[model samples]
Target: MPKTFYQFLMTQRNPESYDTIANFANNAFLDSAFPKQETEFDPLSKYLEENAPYLPSMTIFDDAWQLYLASLA
Candidate 1:
C-alpha cells in the first residue's frame, strides 16, 4: 500500500530528498514563520522530532500540521 502523508513524514530518513517539504515551502504554502526556506529545510523535520511526544501516534503529519495551524487561527 502507498504511504500516508504522515507515515511518509515520520519515516522520512532523508527529508532533504523528500519532495513535499520543498513543494509546500514554495508559493507561501508554508508560513513565513518557518525557520528556513526549502533550500535549507530541517525545521519541519526538527519540528516532528521535537513534538513527536505530543503529536498523535497515528501516521498523519499533514493533519497534524493542519491542526497546528488551525490552533494559530
Candidate 2:
C-alpha cells in the first residue's frame, strides 16, 4: 500500500531552509484532520493556508510538493 503523505513526509530529511514546513509536518503528524491521504497539492495547500496561517511562507510546501512528486517516479 502507498504510504500516507504524512508518513512519506516524515521520512524526508528536513530542509534547513524550510524549517517551518518541517515543523508543520511534525505537527501534522498529530493532526487527525490533516489530509494525510491526499496526493494533490491544491487541497493540501488550502488546508495549510487556512489551518496554519502562522506559517511564514508557502515556498516550503512548494518545494516539498516537488520532492513528493519526484518520489513517485
Index of the highest-TM-score prediction: 2
Instruction: Count clashes in each candidate, considering only residues at least 3 apart in sequence or on different chains.
Output: 1, 0
Instruction: For model 2, name the residue pairs that clash.
Output: none
lDDT by residue for model 2 (1-73), tens: 6555666677763546456657656666666778878877889899988886545678877877777777777
Residues 1-73, candidate 1: write the lDDT tens digits. Answer: 3333333333433435544433333312333333333211245656545644433332344544554444435
Task: Name the lDDT of candidate 1.
Answer: 0.40
Candidate no. 1 TM-score: 0.25
lDDT of each: 0.40, 0.72
Those runs of model 2 whose alpha carbons end farther than 4 Å from true positions after fitting are 13-21
What is the TM-score of candidate 2? Answer: 0.72
Most lDDT-accurate candidate: 2
Model 1 clash number: 1
lDDT of 1 at 26: 36
